[model samples]
Target: MDLQYVNFFAVAVLAAVIGVTLIVVHLSQRKLRAELTQLREELALWQKAGLHAPRAVAAAEPDARPSQAQGAPMAPAPQPLSEEQIRERLQQAAGAGEAPERYRHVVTLADKGLAPEEIARVLQVSSAEAQQLVRLAEVGRKKS
Candidate 1:
């Protein structure tokens, strides 16, 4: 084949690949956006029904742990955490820029008297990290 023809073919192939990739990305983003919107709507419903925490978190109380350890069923429902309370906790979390936002949220929830497990569930963090943040918050409180 002529050099110019070979170059044209390669460019055409590259353009086709780019086009396919852009289409794939666009479709993936659309799917993700739809899923996110659905989740947000479900969250709004749950909030309206006064169910902020999961059933598992309801059984995470210090007094409730013993029953769970013995294979008892979880609590009927978690305490109703109002939207205003969540907003207040987030506002407190926003006050400190010394740590990452996730860490700050964890500490704020801990300070608000939420258990490590509850904080983990609310913030979508690992339980171990939430426990550490809670302990860190405790130490900070003691120092002040």
Candidate 2:
């Protein structure tokens, strides 16, 4: 009778372990299925919104006209200022009594294609202040 009881207890423990394992596996599968369904729904919504699909026109077409001559060399675009023109403008600005020597470096930096942030770093000023200096230089040039 004791042997019979030990055998039954062993079976019961095994059954309990199997039941717990099955429950865990079932819960994991259920979670995965739910996530897959949610992802599928989102994919469908994206398709309906035309966000997931490519358009009929894949890319813009190029211009039909020939851009260059068959044998002739291409000419460069005209610069905003020649060396002489720049000197004349600077002389004129000085004569007209613009901001003194202190601000000339700011204009030179701007003319060299340095951004306002970089100019600010070089001049030890805020970007906004540097931009103001650039604007003043532009207005001065326009006036000249």
Candidate 3:
């Protein structure tokens, strides 16, 4: 009778250990699944917010032409000037002492084929003026 009781107690202890281990495994699996679901939700929300959206460029479409329906006419092309004309203008400005030293440097650089923006940086002039100087220099070169 004592041997039978010992056998039953041993089996009961083994069953209890197996049940606890299964419960722990199930709980861990559930936690992992919940974390995976949360991550998926966050990724979906980010995509919906357009974080990975495609960009549209008007120039990219060759067939989609600019609308001329608006009454704005295209500006006339600038006329090229003679080198003598450009030199005379510079000389006149220099004679008056009103021309900034930077403007002279920009004209010199533009004559040497430096882009307007680069000339502007070197001469510390506004980019618009640098562009104008570059155009004038181009015209002067062509006329010469």
Candidate 4:
């Protein structure tokens, strides 16, 4: 191909890539918005019903090892964790810096005593990510 033709092709390819990227981003935003709407509905229901925490949930077992892990000592599930216990678990899971605003929100929720799993659900992030955010938030808190 002529050098001029090659340059034109490259520019066209770049434009196509940018267009595809924009479409993908728009779709992702729409999906996230839908998730947010669903979360709001759930929150409203929870508020209207005056929901309370169950007596015991997995949050209590901070040190409890998974039953199926190799060579790990399996422990019985502990009783339900107190608000403080849950908050601590969430905070301990946090770290610092990648997404300060998001992590800050995670920390706030953790302080409100939401379990890591619950925070994960509401935020549409994985439980591991939620934990990490909490840890980051704690580290930031200590520094400031």
Candidate 5:
């Protein structure tokens, strides 16, 4: 092929590659936006319920301190829920089932002020999942 034809073919291929890359990026952005919106909605629900990690649990772990400087005034800790309250919350969150018993156990561990890591160890779940369950219990109690 002539040198001119070869150069033209290379440019055309480059353009096609760029077009496909743009399309992929556009689709990825749309998926990420949708996920972000869903997460925002969930966060709003939690906030409306006035949920946060229990204060007593935070105090028990030395590393769970607020990010604020030592001199800064910390936000007042939320009142800890009684074990009975925790069980009630777990029942509500878990719903009616033998499986809910597992969820109920989460609050039992949490009621003792166990950290998520300890809870994970007891429940054989990932620490992150244990944390989520703890938050779920918190949300359950705060709801209504």
Candidate 6:
């Protein structure tokens, strides 16, 4: 085969891969748009329910401490918190990993006779998770 033909074939393959990637990206974007819409709706509901996180401390808020006189004595430093205290204070910090509340809630809802779909919708979790929760709750019930 000619080197020129081989080069052209490689270039053609590269173009095809790029085209397919772009198509996949377009499809993914569409799915993301749908998810965005759902998220917006959930956010609105959260706002209406007054479930928003605390507002960030902004520059507009005045400092709580008044300016000290030029020779004011320094305040005593606060004692350091213990490891358990620090862990308690840092509950749910970033990188803490998955919370089990959803699983517990799923089991609770299942025990309350809610279907897997209803539990998933109420908890905003996957149907599979809700089903597993129901199974877990059933096992517990049998064990007890």
Could you estimate the TM-score for every candidate?
0.40, 0.34, 0.31, 0.37, 0.40, 0.37
Q: Write candidate 2's Cα lDDT for 53-80 as tens digits.
A: 2212224232322345555354453335
Q: 88-144, model 5: which lDDT tens digit per residue?
A: 656754575443544566777788788888776555455666776787667666763
Worst-scoring 10-residue span by lDDT in model 3: 53-62
Question: Candidates 1 and 6: which is better by TM-score?
Answer: 1
lDDT of each: 0.64, 0.64, 0.61, 0.63, 0.66, 0.58
Model 6 alpha-carbon drift over 4 Å, by segment = 53-144
Residue 92's lDDT within candidate 1 is: 63
Q: Global lDDT for candidate 3?
A: 0.61
Please tell me which model should have the higher TM-score, number 2 or number 3: 2
Span of 10 residues, lowest total lDDT, candidate 5: 49-58
Better of 1 and 5 by lDDT: 5
Which regions of candidate 4 deviate over 4 angstroms? 52-144
Q: Comparing 4 and 5 by lDDT, which wins? A: 5
What's the lDDT for candidate 2?
0.64
Residue lDDT tens for model 3, 35-131: 9997687556446544432123322343333333655454443455566776777667657866544454555556666777666554444567677
Give me the overall lDDT of model 5: 0.66
* Backbone N/Cα/C clashes per model: 0, 0, 0, 8, 0, 0
| Native-to-model Cα distance after best TM-score fit, residue 121 in candidate 5, in Å | 15
How accurate locally is residue 133 in candidate 3, as Cα lDDT from 0 to 100?
74
Q: Enumerate residue pairs that collide in model 2.
A: none
C-alpha lDDT (0 to 100) for residue 15 of candidate 1: 100
Candidate 2 or 3, higher lDDT?
Answer: 2
- Evaluate model 6: give its lDDT: 0.58
| Pairwise lDDT winner, candidates 1 and 6 | 1
Give the Cα-based TM-score of candidate 6 against the true structure.
Answer: 0.37
